[model samples]
Target: MRSQENGPIKIDGIDKMILNAFMENANIPVSQLAKDLGISNTAVHQRIKKLETSGVIDSTKVIVNPTVLGYSTMSFVGVFMNKPSSYKLVLNSLEEIPEVIEAHFTTGNYGIFLKILCRDNLHLMNVLNQKIQQIEGVTRTETIISLEQPIVRQIKL
Candidate 1:
């Protein structure tokens, strides 16, 4: 099952061209897509459908401006668990916290990595003290707040 998704994606020349076009403009019109790919509109539509079904393409969405919405800080928290069996409970608890934008289980000094976003230092402190640190298995947390976000990419294609 893993190999099926990992294996070569069956893309023809037209599909690659279509993906290139979509990379530039996700909301491109079907007629324009066909024109850009030099294929029939129906072919472009079918290829897009295939890409979506194969998970080569995900849904298009508007990028939210974090500064506009008052989310000024982005922080990474490295959480260390007290015990070996604590990982599951810690992960479940982390999943319930909305501020945890991204989390990953790692094989290193830290058991979990959490990407957190908040409006200010006060908000982050509260979240760490009142929410994250209170989780059952959490022993220690190390936080690094972002000074600047130089590059952010959704994906090229």
Candidate 2:
């Protein structure tokens, strides 16, 4: 994808088609995608290369099911900081905790918001009290347990 005047990256219909196909199945063979798109394998390969080089396509990842691994609890925690300057330190410390799957420096009532996965409520409690709360810059936390994730998707191209 290339942009005009360094504006938003522009993608043609073909690029959108390729991206949509990959979004459905990342492991789709280039030849199959080429056949579906009515393009040569070389063209498909070149387009994918261009997309990757332009940073339009990030890395392909294997989606892991946390429940299968005994991680049944998913919680969102809003972390309150003792001071604004302590953010980096708190963030660095949070990175050490494996249960913290995602963290965001956000606006509003929280300094940092985190997505945590654990085996159960007790495991979550342990993480919150013994791990997150123990961090020097961390003052308090508010957690919301996710009972079900009804919708999870990427933005439509």
The prediction achieving the highest lDDT against the true structure is: 2
Q: List candidate 1 stretches off by more than 4 Å.
A: 1-6, 154-157
**Following a full C-alpha superposition, what root-mean-square deviation does model 1 have from the true structure?**
2.5
- TM-score of each model, in listed order: 0.87, 0.96
Per-residue lDDT of model 2, residues 1-157, tens digit only: 5743587778899999999989989999999999999999999999999888787888889999989989999999999998999999999999999999999999999999999999999999999999999999999999999999999888879
**Candidate 2: what lDDT?**
0.95
For 38-139, candidate 1 gives per-residue lDDT tens digits of: 779888788888888888777877878888999998999999999979999999999898889999889888999999999999999998999999999898
Clashing pairs in 1: none
